[model samples]
Target: MTDEISHPITMDKRVDLALAGAVVATGLLAIWMAHDFRIGKFPDPLTSRGVPYIAGGALVAGGALLAFRRLSGWRDLPGHLTVSEGTEDEAGHPASSLRAFAIMACAFVWAALLVPAGYLIATPLCLCGMMWAMRVRAPLRLIGFPVGFTLITWVIFAQMLNVLLPLGPLAPLARRLGLMY
Candidate 1:
């Protein structure tokens, strides 16, 4: 005789539901806030409110999709995977949770350093540190990801969007590096 206990629900599904609920709520709030917006005298057909409304609508639609998938049990998970009971390791040494803590610390450090060092310097350091902590094997990727992220953020904020980013004491250095004006 074989007895099997089945759990009708999964933690993954619960997480999805929670995320969906939050996103939907946030979208609704965005839409509500958007209603109060008024573009002045000579407003374009696409006003300041247009992008926010579109983004909020997209978020709402995505949240609805996630909620529907969870309710319908249409999960894109592998069937071969099985959950193992207990938390003890084979060698009896507890696995380190410090890695997660380290990542969070790195993010906090990056945020703290952002204004002083600017995003160009702080972001790449954070990305490299995170990749190292995560034990990424590809050496090229270790260098590439950080540099790519920094360049993209720089381009988007400083050039394309024309948003002023503080260069801190390195304003001249950044200008010499041809990244900032």
Candidate 2:
């Protein structure tokens, strides 16, 4: 018998293809929806629809590339896929699908609470939850990373981009602290 192992069609391939298709479809939908945006009265280098168009196009290109790679049997790809690598966790134990589900659930909760709880409150909680799900037990990292990240993003969007993020009950305090105008 030959020492070389055979790689057959597998469920993982199907799942990857399906995800790629979904990304492409989502991109197409974004492009379609962006076309319907109302024209602004003010003249600007980048219009309201520009970002969506760019983002959608990037998604389409990336998804198409991934699909092509998958269809072409990952030719010239650097690494070889092994069953042990895909199935095991960092500790060499069987990976738990529950972690993935928890992360997804956290994201959904974050989205749901974003408007009501505001970015500062909702985002940190979501980040902490995801970190916990990922088995990060350090107290400093769990608190510091999320808070720092949220503040940085808040400044970027609110101050630099001049985009308004819902402050919810923090509006008064933020105004007092000059965090928002």
Candidate 3:
């Protein structure tokens, strides 16, 4: 009875291992690429090579950790799988592959529109579309979350990272509004 009650949820270990392997491979590639990064007389610490090295290292470390956790926890793994994590699927309707595909389609649309439609418009639409596909019923979250997330992303990318994302038509408006800083 206790054995049945304490059975741990599990996914295939090979999947995680493969993902981790890919991450490690990517990290190795990053390190290799960083070796040839040309340095000038003066360059910011993260501008030349630090960002890629940090990102690739983090990915490799995180993937390794996930792979290790998944592999170690495989003994009590389920014979079959449905949801990947937690008991979210136990509430009657389980996770759907169709929904995942729809969300991926939304991402592709957002990427497609990013250059032409501008960040403010394309990001919010993508978020809303994904939320709709995921069946979010709350109106506030459906509306507010995307705007908030997009603004946060914009601040980080534009102000902190100094990335010049294409503003498209909003370029003039933002310029007039003194928002391009």
Candidate 4:
């Protein structure tokens, strides 16, 4: 006979339902907030807040689908996708929640530093920190990946699309380098 797995704490059905419900509720709030957006003074046809509305819509649809799937028994979750606080290693140590918290904290740190450091500097540093935290051991990537990602973003957004990425403290330097408006 085959066994059905159960993890009451983190992988419970009720927990998944609650999470999906929260996502759906948050998405609805996002949609409601987006309705209050006002057109900016720019001549551009697309309003500043237009993308938020689209994102809110996607969140709503995705959350609804998640709720439906979670509430239904039509599908079975693969082993790796299930969360279990009880899982133990050969040393009998439980899985670390520290990694998840560190990743989330890094995002908050990135956002806090973003305005002061600007896209050119902040993004690369944030990417490097995040990669390191995720245990990406490649030295070349640790150095080169952030630079490549930042340059690609700069080219696509600033150079090709003429979008004004936040220059922050690098405004003058970027202007001198012909990388920013």
- TM-score of every model versus the real structure: 0.53, 0.67, 0.61, 0.66
Off by over 4 Å in 3: 1-16, 33-43, 61-88, 148-165, 176-181
lDDT of 2 at 7: 52
lDDT minimum window of 10 residues, candidate 1: 78-87
lDDT of 3 by residue, 1-181 (tens): 3653333435556776788888878887887798788876686867678877888788788878877876676665455432255444667778899999999999999999999999988999999999999999799999999999999999999878989887888989988988785
For every candidate, C-alpha RMSD to the true structure in Å: 7.9, 5.6, 5.1, 6.1
Error (Å) of candidate 3 at residue 118 is 1.0
> Where does candidate 1 clash, by residue pair?
none
lDDT score, candidate 4, position 48? 64
- Judge candidate 3 against the unseen true structure and give its global Cα lDDT, from 0 to 1: 0.82
lDDT of 2 at 159: 84
Sort by lDDT, best first: what order?
2, 3, 1, 4
**Candidate 1, after superposition: displacement of residue 17 in Å?**
4.2
**Candidate 2 lDDT tens digits, 131-180:** 99989999999999999999999999998998999877898999999888
lDDT (CA) per prediction: 0.78, 0.84, 0.82, 0.77
Model 3 residue pairs with clashes: none
Question: How many clashing residue pairs are found in candidate 4?
Answer: 0
Put down candidate 1 lDDT per residue, 104-174, tens digits, no spaces.
98899999988998877888889888888787769789989898988898888888998887766779887
For residue 170, model 2's alpha carbon misses the true position, in angstroms, by 1.9
lDDT of 4 by residue, 79-115 (tens): 3234554544558544557866877887888788777
In candidate 2, stretches whose alpha carbon ends up further than 4 angstroms from where it belongs are: 1-9, 12-19, 61-96, 155-163
Candidate 1 residue spans exceeding 4 A from truth: 1-18, 34-44, 68-112, 137-163, 174-181
